[model samples]
Target chain A: MRTEAGPPVTVVVGAGLVGASIGHALTGAGWRVHLVDAVPSHAMVAAGLGAGTAEPAEPSEVGLVVVAVPPRTIADVVGESLQTYPYATVTDVGSVKAGVLDALWERPVDLTRYVGSHPMAGSHHSGPVTADGDLFVDRTWVVTPHRKSAEASTARVVELVRACRARLVTLDVDDHDAAVARVSHLPHLVSVLMAGHLTDVPEEDLVLAGQGLRDVTRIAGGDPGLWQQIVRANATAVLRELRQVAVSLDRLITAVETAPTDEAPADLSLSRELERGVDGTRRIPGKHGSAAVPYEQVVVAIPDEPGALARLFGDVEAAGVNVEDIAIEHDASRQVGYLTLSVQPERAEGLAVVMRDGGWTVV
Target chain B: MRTEAGPPVTVVVGAGLVGASIGHALTGAGWRVHLVDAVPSHAMVAAGLGAGTAEPAEPSEVGLVVVAVPPRTIADVVGESLQTYPYATVTDVGSVKAGVLDALWERPVDLTRYVGSHPMAGSHHSGPVTADGDLFVDRTWVVTPHRKSAEASTARVVELVRACRARLVTLDVDDHDAAVARVSHLPHLVSVLMAGHLTDVPEEDLVLAGQGLRDVTRIAGGDPGLWQQIVRANATAVLRELRQVAVSLDRLITAVETAPTDEAPADLSLSRELERGVDGTRRIPGKHGSAAVPYEQVVVAIPDEPGALARLFGDVEAAGVNVEDIAIEHDASRQVGYLTLSVQPERAEGLAVVMRDGGWTVV
Candidate 1:
């Protein structure tokens, strides 16, 4: 991503969200990024957005080549990039890894220059137009280097992650696939299945929907064609996780079907499933790889007017609390709304006191 | 809940989050609220939070009695409230309406005054301490009036919902349960199943977790005991939804299990499922019960210093864009982070220009 002379020279193949994001970040850092794509307009569009310039004549100058393409085509693209860009370290932004490695097993390519990496950062929104240079900042980026990968090449991939301002997590290629299957791919399909239930539901019935259903279904809006490739690419690991989920579903179904209207069974499998979910959430690492810190919200009634949020948040800043997040409970028809400021658990009371004394209603 | 001469008088029983929230909302509307609970200390805490005063002896003066007890106890408490408070319209905020109505069928109490309501607003944060009067503002509150419910009683319940500033959706008791089964109960279980998959996963593997996983599993952390009661109370409808989800899960599992690593089948059931998911998300009503508006995010990189957010958002407001929501991406060790401002899709470009012109880095 960066070089000793001016900036790193690299070739970004496939001008999509991930690729254009990389190109944008690298160009902003003064890198000479050569953007290329099978669809010529895609590369041109990314270049027009200042992600990078058109493919340069001197391909051998690129110190690194990032293959950002569809999962089904990643191996072929990576293979071609390695063959075409001699002396360059080759990496990719593919979500899944083992399939690419399996596809590359018999290919007559130099494996020493190849290191596989997956930036855990992504959005349901796709295409170059949705790209942002800061998308990967502070996000966990998993780098997987196979046994045949040279140490120098892996280091280069590591630098790519660091240059993007992303946190790096290293694992073997197969381990990366399995971990992503459970953490990313499995949860994705879970979202998809839940959303599938919604397609046939009556629209009038949807008024009952709240934040919970919205949260559970939000990621189901990702491009279906791309997801089809991802699911198929990581089929083995994904299938393993999916089967386990199937087991839980059957158990929960039985629990609900036989549940008595008068009283819950003494041995409540339903409660057990809900409890297990709590434990599962606990397993997710918090920011900076720490235990998840639970933040509490201090709801304040903010008048529906301009500059209201600024004045309120200014007071929150004056209270000397680092607001972790904020949510505005809004409706088109409401004149008064609530703004929930998420702060450290221990600081909520002090912040609430300051706001209340400052002529604010702390709900 | 309000009367002509003074604020309307009402009794809110069960001082949990929902109950205390009702007490808080009603009290803020200038109504005299009486809070009671099986655990008297809970009622006292809610009273301490200014939700209401402790229950008074003269309950007959109240126009409405809100039974906010647990689902299993809702029938008994509601029946008792009707018997105790003559001339008061009795309603309960049990999530499942059918079970409560079924339980009240053989009671000697006057069924004429009883109505079932479910306020869709909630948080994983529990207890009276987490209650806010604005919690129900703009939230959909369903009023389920059975055949036995009198118009006067239903009107009083609707007034309670209005007093809380909640949007009202009236349905038959059975229809209410069925709708909630699809929209609320089913999604809850899907989240539970997804989160349950994480429970046994290695902590190291969880480093790959992202916002999508956090969102999908969030409601899974709700009180297991309460969820157990809710699932049992709405068993029949929930069982039907669960059976269908199980069917979808089976189909999805089959698709993934047989997905060839080399090439996908001509008839891609996987893609079909993903497409179905996209269609389902379209069904979710957006703000003010309209079609979900696709908000676009304009990410800006901001220095990690106090007052940066206040100033940045101040400009956003000045730029004539209403921020639908905001998210800050942070890690323990970053000096700079990204703040994504969500705006109407059409206004994104204009906001970005205004931001950049104002010396902000619109990434």
Candidate 2:
């Protein structure tokens, strides 16, 4: 059995968000990392952008190889690497596992040293410009190991994921596609559809679109090329889920058209619909595989200044409060900002009371 | 012209999230607030739940009455209110306007004393229990008036909204409905459709749902009764937008099915699709009717403890930087938490540098 000792040698392919992040994480953990990309200039980009690297060499020299290329290119990149160097246990960080696995099936490579992976972590921003070393520090990293995948190889990949401070989740290729379709892919489609509708709005009317719309449709602004590949790869499941959404929307249309009156239903009221929304939403995973955490709010008044919020936070800290999440709204005309602090449930009321006593206009 | 003093006597009907919040806001601003509802027991429940009082005599002497009842009942309530009580300027806060305006059209009362308003602020959390005195602060409160509405009556309602510290936008009834359909109703439909898809998930699989899914579908958990009223009231525009969304989703589905392999069209890649998504998303209005603010993230490491996060905030403040938004993630098993601070563009790098130098791990 190989002993877990000093930093392992990790090689990450593709100098983008996923790849660089892996390298950055491994390097931060004291690992000897060699990042590779098809573009020779990628080594410099990756190193300078902070994921770390060197020239690619024999795979046998490294403990693991993480393929972080595009979905369309993942198979080719993994296959090529395996063809040239055969000793390292290889894994991939592709969004769609089945497609990559299917493409790699016919390749003349060692089957034992290969595993399929997808770290369910991303940002609204993309490419190296948005690269950060801690991108996967506390996110879920999914590993899809087929029946033929060697146990040792799977364990090694899981170790690498854990070393990067990510929670490990095991699944089959098909299940991964289906699960991600429901959670990630379907949301993107919904966002895109809503965003497409906005295009039809008259410019003047469109100007009134607010935070609610922006928050709901935020994911619409994703990389189209990348999303096309993901949707195409996972089309069957995405389409199946999209059909379900269509049916739900159709029922809503019918119900709205036939409502007893314009007033909300007395019993099933809008609250019930919203409750269902909340229930389903809670089923989502939270920080590092924990259950989803709902937001709790605390309203604080802030003066208009460069560091007003920093001062408010400092004041909240002085009052012995821990803020879990925060949202800020500024009224430029009034020259003030409303800071909404989302804390743990038990702490919310206490913090609010404390902030109130602290005299920062705790709203 | 009349000289205005401090707060006016205000009456709120229904005592729900909207009504109670209005009452609380008005009362906080030094107004004599009279809250009324159909059920006497509801008043106790409302006040106990944080909504406010429901005294009948309060409306008898008030200068303005805000009917916060459901859309369907607004017409009957407003019609009766206008004929029954002739002393005060009258207003109603309903999602839809055309119906309410139609109900009031033939009333043998002073139309000059009536104005219609809808505050574009709400919570998935309903009723008096979640009533916040500052709920409308910094949010848009749309004031819709008929062509014959008296300027003084309109000003009265506008003053109330202003006192609540909300931004005011004046529009005709039809314009309000159309605007809300694009910004509010359509988003609700999309959220509901997406959340309803959760019904199809295998129970075991859904237990693994994560924050991304919850974020996109959170609004789906809205009050079905309120949504029903809202959708029915704005049926035409909601249906039109839904059809538009359906068409766009269908196109996306088609693209997924027929897009070429590695030879994908220039704009068909997922990355490209996501880029378009971002572009369209940026079009939504943000604070001050400006472009939506995108965050610059600063990830910091915190120890797991009650006062750890508070202390971090203290240090963040000492760094002399303002945090625009914040998200925290705690890895229980690891005994550490990752706190992400969203700061203005120029401050992120400087703050990160300072936090790191201050002996804290800033990623």
lDDT tens per residue, model 2, B1-363 = 113566566667787778888878887777877667887675566666544455565434567888988887888888777765666778988878877787677878788888999886664333213566877877778899898789888999999899889888888888888888987788877877777677667654553454446556857766666677777778777777777776666666666666565665554444444555666776665556665587678877786555666567677878888776565654323335667787888888888888888877765
DockQ, candidate 1, comes to 0.58
Per candidate, native contacts kept equal 0.69, 0.42
Every prediction's TM-score for the first chain? 0.87, 0.86
User: Candidate 1's residue-wise lDDT over A1-363, tens digit each?
Assistant: 234554457899989889999988888777778999999999999999999998563766778999998887899999998888887899999999988888887899998999999987655434324677877777778899998999989988888898888888899988888988988889889999999999877777787777678889988888888888888888899999998898889988877766544464464677788899888877776655667888888888887666677788778778888777666655433445667777789999999999999998786
Please give the distance, in angstroms, between residue A209's alpha carbon in candidate 2 and its true position after superposition: 4.1
What TM value does model 1 have? Answer: 0.90
Worst ten in a row by lDDT for model 2 chain A: A123-132
Specify the highest-DockQ model's number: 1
TM-scores, each model vs. reference? 0.90, 0.86
lDDT digits (tens) for residues A238-317 of candidate 2: 88887777766666656555546447444353344555665665555554455557656777767755556555666677
lDDT, candidate 2, residue B362? 68
Q: After superposition, how far is residue A314 of candidate 2 from its true place, in Å?
A: 3.9
